[model samples]
Target: MRNYFIDLLTKEAESNNKIMLMVGDLGFSVVENFKEKYPKQFINAGVAEQNMTGMAAGLASEKFHVFTYSIANFNTFRCSEQIRNDIDYHNYNVTVVSVGGGLSYGALGYSHHAIQDYALMRSFPNMTIYAPGTRSEITNCMKQIFKSKSPAYLRLGKTLPKNFKKLYKPNHCAPGKWTKILECKNPDSRKCILTTGAVIDDAVQMQKKEEFSNYHIYSLPIWGMQYKTLQAKQINKWDEIVTLEDHLEDGGFGSYILECNSNIKTAGETKIKLKSLNKNVCNTVGDQDNLKEHFKFAH
Candidate 1:
C-alpha cells in the first residue's frame, strides 16, 4: 500500500508542481524516488512531527497540497494538537499520510499501534479519512484527496493481505459511498460485511465461513463526521450489517456507523453488528498475525 501511494504520488507530481511530500525523518528507502526526482517538493522535517505538520500547513497556505508522511502514531497522536490547530482548523490542503495502520507495527509494542487513530482523526470536523483496504483503492483515494483540497488523512498498511486480488477498474471513492467487492450468491441475501482499512481481508475470510457464507463484502474507504446522513440512508437498505475494523470498539469504524444511525428514525430496524479487536490485544505484542489471533475479532 505504501509503494502504491508513493508511486501514485510520483506520477501525480510529474505534472503537478504544487504537490509536496514532507517526512518526519522516516520513509528512507520508500521515498527516495520522489525525493531524487523532485528535490524541491520533498522536505525532511527531522524527528519533530509538530513542526512538520505546522510547516506543511504553511506550505498549503501558499497553494500547495502537502503530504506529511511517517509511521502511524508519530504523524498523528504525537502531533495531534498541531494537526487540529494548524491544518484541520484552517482547512488546509495538507494530507496526513500514515503508514503501518492498525497493528502493522505490533512487533514494536503498543506505542506504535494505531488502533485509535480513527478516533482522534474523526474528531476534527474538517478531516476526511482515507483508509484503502487494497492497492487499487489507493489510486481512487488519491484522486479524491487531490480533488478535496482540504484536510485529509491517508492511512496505509505495511503490506498487502494474503490472497488479495487486484481490481481492473476501481471507482472513485467518496465519503459514505461503498465499493462492492464480493457479491453474495444468494439473491435473497441482504446481509453484508462492511469494512475500512486493512481489516478488509478478515471480512472476506469471515464471509467464507458457513455461518456467514451468504454475506456480501463491501468497503467504505473514504468517510468522515460530515457523512452521517448519507451513511444512515445506506444502513437502512440492508437487513443486517457487520462492520469490521482492527481498531477498538470505541471511536472506531463500528462506533462511527452506530453514531450515524442513532438519530435516524428508519434505521432502527436494521441490525448493526460490530467486529473489532479486543482491548486485551493491547496488552500482548509479538507480531501482527499473533496479536490478531489472540483477540479473535471480539464481538
Candidate 2:
C-alpha cells in the first residue's frame, strides 16, 4: 500500500502541479521512487511532523493540494495541532497520509501502535477518515481525495495482501466520506460482524459456509459514518453487531459504534447488545497473522 501511494502520488503530482508531499523522515525504500522523481514537490522534513504539517497547510492555503506523510502517530497525532488549526480549521486542501495505521510495527512495541490516531484525528471538524482494506482501494481512494477539497485522513495498513494486484470491490464506501456496509448474508442468525480495515478478511471468513455460517457481516471501514443512515441500513439487514478492529476500542471502530455515532452502534446500544474485540497496543510478537489470531480476528 505504501508503494501504491508513492506511485499514485507521483502520478498525481506530474499531472496536477498543485499536489505536494512532505515526509517526516520515514518511508525509506517505499518512498524513494517518489522522492527521486519529484524532489521539488517532495520535502523530507525530518522527524518533525508538526513542522511538516504546518508546511503542508502553508502550501494548501496557496491552493496547492498538500499531503503530509509519516508513521500514523507522527502524521496524525504528533502534528495534530497543525492539522486541526491550519488545514481542518480552515478546510484547507490537504491530505494526511499515515502508514502503520494499526499494529503495523508490532515487533517494535506499543509506541508504534496507532491505536488512538483515529480518535485524535477525527475530533476535528471537516476531516474525513478513511481506512482502505485493499491495495486497489488505496490508489482509488487517493484519486478521490485529490479531487476533493475537504481535508482527509488516509489510514493505510503496513503490509499488502498477497494478491496485491487483485481488485476487491470497496465495501460500498469506495473512497466515500463515511462508513458503508460492504456485504451481508446469513440473516437468520441475527449476528453481525462489524469490521474495519483489514479485519474485512476475518469478517468474510467468519460468514463462510461452516465457520460462522449463520451470522451476517458488515464492513464500516470509514469512521464518522452517519448513524441515522447506518441504523436504517442495519434495521433493514441484521440484528446484533460485534465490532472487530486491530486498534483500541476507545477511538477506533468500536468506539464509533459504542458512542451511538454509528447507526449500528446506536441500535446495538439501545436495542441489541453490542460487543467488541480490540487492542490498545501490540500484544504479541511475530507477524501480522499471529496478532490477528491472538485477537480473534482469525482463528
Candidate 3:
C-alpha cells in the first residue's frame, strides 16, 4: 500500500503542481520518494502535529490541495482540534492520508495506535471518511476524494493482508450506507459476520475450524451499512453479529454501530458485540498477533 500510495501521490503532484505534501515528522524512508520527486511541495513539519494541521489548512485556503501525511494517531488524534476548526470547520480542500490506520505499529504500543480516528473524523460535519480494503481500492479512494467538495480523510494500513487485493475494489461510491458482502464457501448460512481490515481474515479462519451454521463474513468499510436495518436483520436471522477489528472498543467501529441505532436497548449496548484490540500501552510485545493475544483478541 505504501508503494502504491507514494507513487500515486507523486504522479498526481507532478500533474497538479499546486498540491502540497505536509508531514508531522514521521515519514522516513516510506515517503522519501515523494520528497525527492517534489522537493518544493513536500514540507516536514517536525513533531508539531497541531501546527502541521494548521499550516495545511492555511495552505488549502490558498486553493492548494493540501495533503497531510503521518502515522495513524500522530496525524489524526494529535491535531484533531486543528483539523476540526481549520479544515472541517472551514470546509477546506485538504486531504489527510493516514497510514498505520489500525495496528500497523502494533509493536509500538498505544501511543501509535489509531483506534478512534474513524469515529472522531466521522463526527465532523464537512469531512468525508474513507477506508479502503486494498491497494486498488486506495487508488480509487484517491480519485474519489478528488471529486469531493469538502475535506477528506483516508484511513490505510501499512501492512495489509493479501486477501484484500483479490476480494476488494479501491473506490469510494460513498462512506455510510456503503457495504460489500463477499460470498463465502457456504451461501445458505444465516450467520453474517461483520468485520473490517485484516481481521476479517481471522473470521474466515474461524469458519474453517468449524463451519459456523449460516455464518458469513461481511467486510464493512468504515461507516458502512445502515445500522438500524442491519440490527433488525441480525436480530431476526442470526444469533450473533460479531464485530472484529484492531481498535479500541470505544470511539471505533463498534461505537459507529451504536451511534446509528437510536432506539436500541441491549443492556446499555448495541446488538453487535464490540470486539476490539485493547488500547492499553504495553511494555511487552513481539508482533501484531502477540499484541492481540496479550490483549485477548485471538480467535
For candidate 3, report its TM-score. Answer: 0.82
Q: How well is each residue in 29-116 modelled by candidate 2, as lDDT tens digits?
A: 8888877878888888888888888988888889988888888587887777888898888999898988887777666666677777
Residue lDDT tens for model 1, 44-157: 999999899999999999999999999979999999999999999999999999999999999998998899999999999999999998777888899899788899999998
Angstrom error at residue 5, model 2: 1.7
The list of candidate 3 runs beyond 4 A from truth reads: 165-173, 211-213, 222-240, 263-271, 279-284
Candidates sorted on TM-score, descending: 1, 2, 3
Which of 2 and 3 is ahead in lDDT? Answer: 3
Leading candidate by TM-score: 1
State, as a TM-score between 0 and 1, how close model 2 is to the true structure: 0.83
Q: What global local distance difference test value does model 2 have?
A: 0.68
* Ordered list by lDDT, greatest first: 1, 3, 2
The numbered model that scores best in lDDT is: 1
Per-residue lDDT tens digits for candidate 3, residues 1-299, read 66677788888888888789898887777789889889999999998988989998999889888888888788788889998899999999998888887767777766777777777787787787667655555666677676665688877776555566445453443444434445556666555566655465566555555644345666655343323345443344445566677667776666665554444444333345667766563454446666666766735
Clashing pairs in 2: 231-263
Candidate 1 lDDT score at position 13:
98
